[model samples]
Target: MDSLHHDLTVVEQIEVSPPHATIGCKSLPLTFSDIAWFAFPDPVHTLFFYDHPITQTIFIETIVPTLKQSLSITLQHFFPFVGKLAIFPTSTRIPEIRYVEGDSVAVTFAESDLDFNYITGNHPRECHKFYHLIPLLGSTTKVSDYITIPVFAVQVTLFPNHGIFIGMTNHHNLCDASTRFCFLKAWTSIAQSGGSDEPFLANGTLPIYDRLLKYPKIDESFVKNANVETFDEEYKLPRLSGPTNEVRATFILTRTKINGLKKLVSTQLPTLAYVSSFTVACAYIWSCATKVEKDELAAFIFVIDGRSRLDPPIPAAYLGNCVMPCFTLARTTILKSKEGFVTAAKLIGQNLHKMLSDKDGIVKDIGSFEE
Candidate 1:
């Protein structure tokens, strides 16, 4: 299985839009938070595997249509997923996601001969083996002074008699993890109801697009950092290439294990400002991953959701990035000591506490991030 070659056959490429004439042109401006990611070259890619034995004929006849129709319905409510990221040549004008009447998402249906269990297993596997299942976003197009970049794409791969794989690629400027999760929830609900969005409409929380966050100076700073003025027709999103030594594996911590780690941190550092499963997990991973010399500096950084940290507190369903990074730096000697895990946990916990309890608020020192 480790030596398995990539064997994928393209079934069809289809364009799916919201049900015809259901909505008009819609545009969403990039907030400072979104603008902060404008320079990030990597797009978010995700693969979902489901165990369901089915023949190729059944997959094409029923599964494909159901997913297609349900996705179309999902896009009607979550139009940003189908929109294009539009960036102008000047910092004075903010970038945006624009959805015209006929804008559609590229959805590819394919069949793969690769072993499903091997690819989905917990063991480390060649990263390129899964690359074929990930769909590529459409090429960028420039019109007038602004360039329009396709933001989202989907791929469905069928492994006959094994299972199905759903892969997605989306530009980070469009939204964050929470918003993406909400979109999936709506799509899954509609899918479960046979392509009807009525249930999702009645039960799910609609995305809030009211630009509730405003910090003009911060926006300007991020735009300047992104250097949008230099973007030209040759600009393109960075892409992933194959045939490398890179391997990816998944590591899961059960609830009991996480609890044990938490208890250990609490017992070791009784006065630590914060101690939780997430903090301990991060600390443990950091300590294990760092192999630097005793005196070298090591840093651990992660993002915190800022939806509730805002002055007015943006809605939980806000449709774009609302996260702030927390940085913890310490000498490798401390992290590699006998109490390495506990030391790492204390460093991360104290930094998290400081960020969450900042006297001036989370958005106060936005410019300091670049420093």
Candidate 2:
């Protein structure tokens, strides 16, 4: 199933502002965690394709307006989005992300004639095909000046007669996956209530926007002690880093198969009997992707939420970035060997153990990963 060549027609662009007057003259400082993501892609593209259960009239007359209204009401609590990044060069402090009145979020309503099953099927399809369904972070061309950047953009495309797709592109500096998920859940909850008092707060789905709540736990000793490139120094390859030619497709393994993989890893490494499905999958994929040069090191780097992993857990309502990195470096030759999968799995398991059990913290001492 594939919609490799589907037509996407953007019908309307609406700015959903807060339902009530938002208090202005407020600014939230960018946490150290947020500043590090200045150059990275907004962590995720939240996309989902849902089957059409209502007639076009109901969808257009009832669904769209409700969603837009709910979004506006939701923004009342998350008013910072109506804000923009405020930067000062001479200040020792981090730039502030500010919110102002009349600021609005852009939502595009679109239509597509693409085959619903083909576009949302469980079969292998071109990864690029799904790119269009998700809207870009900002509507205008890339701005060298960071002050004017839009932290969020949303797209809603209806696959007429098939299903409807809603995609939101969010900035990492604004919020992480957990926060985004909470916002989405809140929006739906409000919509489900026919736009009454938000059901999220009643259900305990709240977001903490104060940046100072989650202090930077990353130890800077690594950057200060090690003679490494600072955040600004880096090499260029003349072109962006991406596979211009390669097989990039999604894979879904059933629970039984996942259990089988975990069992296989555990059989080889007794200590990693509780390795997660993600660790197992990464181990398998890394082993398959390596060419094994005996000396070359292949690093499997992944991120974990630091909210709960930190020594003193952060508030559940905190909405900004709090991700920490955990990595495993293995000799290409070892990864290509018969015990390759187990070797990689053990490294990941060890990292997780440290992240969870280490008293000092797995997020201590960090350096830039810029290339």
Ten contiguous residues with the weakest lDDT in model 2: 231-240
Collision pairs in model 1 = none
Query: What clash pairs does model 2 have?
Result: 208-317, 219-365
Name the top TM-score candidate.
1
TM-score of 1: 0.94
Against the reference, the lDDT scores of all candidates come to: 0.87, 0.67
| lDDT (10s digit) by residue, model 2, range 1-371 | 22423477766678888864656566777766666665564435778878885556666787789888888888777765656555442234355666777777888877777677877777766665667777765532222433345577788887766779998876666877777777777778888888764466788556776654434333132222222122211211121223235334567878998899899877778766448998888888888778535568778888888887654467766877778777888888898888887887888888778876766555443322221
TM-scores of the models, in the order given: 0.94, 0.82
Q: Which candidate ranks first by lDDT, i.e. highest?
A: 1
| Stretches of model 1 off by over 4 angstroms after superposition | 1-6, 292-295, 360-371
In terms of lDDT, the poorest run of 10 residues in model 1 is 1-10
